[model samples]
Target: LKVTIAQIDIPCSFGPAYEGERVRGKDLFVQAGGGKTQCTEYLELADMKEIDDGKVTVIGPDIPDMKRGEVFPLGIFVQVGGREFQKDFEPILERQTHHLVNYIQGVMHAGQRDIAWVRISDAAVDKGFTLKDLGVVLHAKLHQDFSAILDKIQVTIYTKKEDVDKLTAKARAAYKYRDERVDKMTDDDVETFYSCTLCQSFAPNHVCTVSPERTGLCGAYNWMDCKAAYQINPTGPNQPIEKGECLDPKLGQWKGVNEFVSKASRGAVTHYNFYSLVQDPMTTCGCCEAIAAMLPGCNGVMTVHREYTGETPCGMKFTTLAGVMGGGASSPGFVGHSKYNITQRKFLVGDGGLLRMVWMPKSLKEEIRERLLKRGAEMGCPDLIDRIADETVGVTEEEIMPFLKEKKHPALDMEPIVG
Candidate 1:
């Protein structure tokens, strides 16, 4: 193994020990994304001649120039150039930003892709940390850890709103293309599913099993990403598990997957479903792109994404829901999932599928409107997207049920959501 320790030059003490620390409202000096501002992280394969190794650039105002409580848009664009590097490796390296950025003391990172969030603490600022140091840490750490596959790295950190907005649009398109790469395939097409324990660093008991239809909750690692990750490092966290016995096909359970998850989570999670959100659903970690909670009054589920700070019909804001169940626990009637998974064919299929989604934040509803409509059409409910309630419609089940009933929302007539 060709291993070279990273020569990190940040002012703050950097290591995995600080991974779980939080930068709260009182201590937060400045922040990016987390629904406060736009934050996007994109990593792409590049030509060897395109980038200078270790070159880190800040395109806008640095941390020292920012005032406390200010929310600045951010785009961390990483270009990796190496003969061994493949485009398939982009998502894996990009997802590493969550943990790698958190390694810096007084800094907390959550989410992935366009919904990524970063908070810099007053402590880190006092220690003379800058946005440049984030680039420095990621550049050094990526090279140090991925030396086998990459040879050159360049990072650009953008704080300008215009620049970040453009990157967010471009990044979202790339994400869509990457996600569709596995759209035509199904879980039964292959005898194996991959495991993603990447978030285990923060949510120690969380074990994310990536099937063809269900992507990782963080919205970064899909089945293809995990498979590629495993191919690169056989003994790494993304290992393949053969689909053994079909213990419960309705809920999408496999005997081999249960055994693997039980051992991997140290027995914290013995089994979970790939298709159902209300029954033994997969463990949720804090970085999920969105969360779904059952709303009994509406006789359906309400979902809230990290970007939507508004109150959901379930009576919890995005941050509150994440705080309560996002700690690597299996909570019935609640499950964390990727935004892309929301439109997938098997999303909550065991609980009557997309027709059961009664409410979502307006922003989230519009963001996935295209795919949502497509999935709705497949279920023979072309107007389901319009029928779904949002914050504008009402933020409480009782308030939304009237509208749902008037609009003839499908969930009202479905089977009971809670057993």
Candidate 2:
């Protein structure tokens, strides 16, 4: 069966502010000014009756029987004639466009004079084309007068199970592709410059620079793609990542990164210094994706992810670690300087050793775990992953605590598992 799909562009205001509208008994029809408004609606003209009226019915806002949030599929099937209808709409049926005139032109080429079958759906309501646009086009074609166009159109009210299954499968395949792409991303693939325009929603002045190996503190946007996007839209939402000078190896300091961050963050961060958490300044921002808090005893640093709100030994937020590690924070041992680079020296021991504990979700932890373990083994230390209690890995908690004690360091406390 030939099926045409079109989506409506409905200006839906259904978030927090719409709660008042919902409570005030403002129906959709009422919101649309009693259907008098010329709203853009998408129409799908099809030759076959693939949609079932029982499955795809439009629920009028004024209908008392309909539930408040009831969503009904709005589609209509019309039979014009047989031979002329088949020749006219068939050619344009496969093409996707908002303009009906384009479809008519294609029909004219096929030597068809009139519309044979037309399907109507409310899916494209809020899009650029409105019901009035359709009426105007039909009236101009002399197919039907504007006054009687509404009567000629029949609404198919129910969505067929097969149609739902087809849509679901299409969506599933797209999601699978995305998942595969993410899984296939390599370290080198991820290590590139990126811009975090999304953060502007929370931090008006803040823009995160991402690289391939590193991601935004919000854990979105890998390096290479972000860099490419910035290049494509130079002054638009994303910008370039200008490299700064190398940081002092011994002191774990970078002059260029510090200067850039100080200015970018609007003096929220100044005089970038690695280590020395107490005397040196910490990262302060109007908005931060993560937060790091010192544990009460200072035995070890505890990093918290923002979404996690339970009792942490350090009471820090994930935004803290993400920001600190992203660089310019005076917290000792925190890596990720200048929002662009992810250096091993920044977080590991030698200079910046104050940052001891890093708490992240399983996904992120797994992504970096193997690399971190290799680094630990090279440094003649037990891998932090081995110390952490995880069923997937063989290392036990017992084996990990001894290493921490032997190294004169306190064991890290992990947050409880969240669903």
Candidate 3:
């Protein structure tokens, strides 16, 4: 069996009619004029026959299967006598039919308008028809007309099976390439700057700026992706980080970052200082992502992640300490007093250190402790491994100190301890 497909255009109209029940014995009369009839005459012309025994199916406006404003195929099917007929029929059809040619032209034009597209799925070769013969019938009558339409429209075609496979492979390769590129960013790969315009919804006067080396306290976009996205759409939601000038290298302070923060935060962040934990310096916050409250009397920093009930040093209730900390100029590294305290030794030495009680949800607490222990070991502060790894709630200073000692860590020996 040989199959051929063609596309055609049609016009249609519609009207509404109501049906009524016939009265008793009298003959019922129905009005048929409400329905439409073709007022114009249809012109027909004899076209060439590709195969001697082929049957032509003309699809026009008269066809009930045609949908309003939709395009459909005027199909043709042919049964060849044998292999010779299969091989020879297509060439004969090409020399004969103008119907196929016109159909192809109409389809191509419609397709270019992004209106209608079509696909033909038939294996003529398996059905005892020569591909060359089929190709000729398609090419002479359809392919050439479709190509003409291509000149006036934007249409793409995949003829060979291998071509479709190649396209699929290429798409997969592109996605893989993108994924790998994103996965390669390290902590030091690129510097990130973050600002939360989103927070403006709740805190009209607040803006949170984040850096590349660290994540936003709220844990939004990382530095690299954030920077890349900003570069992609500068006028979009996320703006690029414009590095101004180096303020202090040892402390990672920059003039541009400070200016941006002050402007974005609406002067909420005025005095931007880096390093030297004290003396009119250090990062300040309105509300922080997590608050590492320092108990001066206890000489320890208590880290409250979020959704924890407790009294903070600043005496503020926190849902997420990060909510307050998310957009600050300070680094997440400086969570506890060890990072910002004037007397670092007070928190860094002996039984009393910056991090004392880590008040976090059970899940987050475990994650933080595990991560800190690993980082501490890498920093050669093995003593901190046990000190921060074990749970801190309800543990007395004495018990905490023994754990610190067990980890072979030394106590604070600063010259002047600050309250």
Candidate 4:
């Protein structure tokens, strides 16, 4: 970390430890994004001649000019040019905006891509901190951390409504293009999958082997995300795991995955089946956003999010299910996964894929309803969405069974899940 910040004068204390501190509404000096306005952060590769080196542009009012507790639309756009930079690394650098900005004292950062939310504390603003300091921190930190690949860094902060709206459209387009590219890719297209041990700091035995269809349990890092992380830091938590052999394509059991997990988990978890929760399922760290549980009565699986407080048809709440399934234990009848992963073609493919999903929290169902409907249609079960039960339908297996039978759910007709 060759961070040289001699030119910029920082007014307040700043570090990683302060990230957990909260800035409640009463204490906040301003809020950006958080559904109040269009907020986006974008990083792009450009020709060296195209940008003014080391320049920071603010297109609207400075921080001091705004009233306290005000809301504003913001856009952070960074363009870098260097011989070593690649287009694939753009999103990788872009993702760092969350952490780098959060390092500023009295500032909080959350979310990524187009839905970034940030807050400034009154304490820092009173100490002379301004929006321009945000750009300075980004410029200095990016140059310091990514100097090997970034020869020149230029940032433009847009606070004006028209400017933010225009930049957000471009940012959203880039986001969609990257997502589609990763979504269309398959495991066969790549020779290696990535292993993420980020959670190993807490759960020592946890290892996440991310593929094209599967993402990190936190629902943040996808295959492309891990790929870029590996390129950025070869010795970091993310590394490539070669796909040695196809042990079971339907179950997504691989020789290399087994070998890596055995070594990473210190032999605690030696066997893993990707698509079936009833077999030797993948172990999870407690950080997973959701858990998939087996519902024997309906011969299907029910997914419950960590935020969901209600019980599921599986007879367990999210907390009970996570406690049973997490801590890097190879437990059949339970698995951990990202919410976005449910729509993938490989999701529980060994146990009938999307058709195996019978129950999920209503909020989660609504969050993923569009994707679920599209996947249902693709699986030749366009009516599957309505057939799947939610909290409103019933929470217990017996309570939901009648509804399943009434809807003629395919899982009711499928083979017994608990053999």
lDDT, model 2, position 138: 33
lDDT of 2 by residue, 41-133 (tens): 223333334423212233233223333333332111222222223222211221111223223211110001111112222222322322233
* lDDT of candidate 4 over 238-333, digit per residue (tens): 899997899999888999989998999898888798888888887876656688988887888899976687777777887787777767787788
Clashing pairs in 1: none
Clashes of 3: 22
Go through the candidates in order and give the clash count of each: 0, 44, 22, 0
RMSD of 3: 24.8
Q: In model 2, which regions exceed 4 Å deviation?
A: 1-8, 13-198, 211-213, 250-253, 266-292, 296-298, 316-355, 358-379, 389-419
Q: Residue 169, candidate 2: how far off, in angstroms?
A: 15
lDDT of prediction 2: 0.33
Candidate 1 structure quality by residue, lDDT tens digits, 1-419: 33365579999999999999999899999999987788999998888899888899999999988998889999999999888888999999998898999999999998889888899999999999999998898889988888889888899999999999998888888898899998998988989999999888878999999999999988899999999999888899999999799898889999999999999999989999988888999999998989999888778888898888878888889889999888899999899999999999999888889999999888888888999989999999999999998888888888888899999999999988876
Worst 10 residues of 1 by lDDT: 1-10
| Candidate order (lDDT) | 1, 4, 2, 3
Better of 2 and 4 by lDDT: 4
Candidate 3 lDDT by residue in tens digits, 199-263: 34334444444443333333323344345444433553346555456665544456776777677
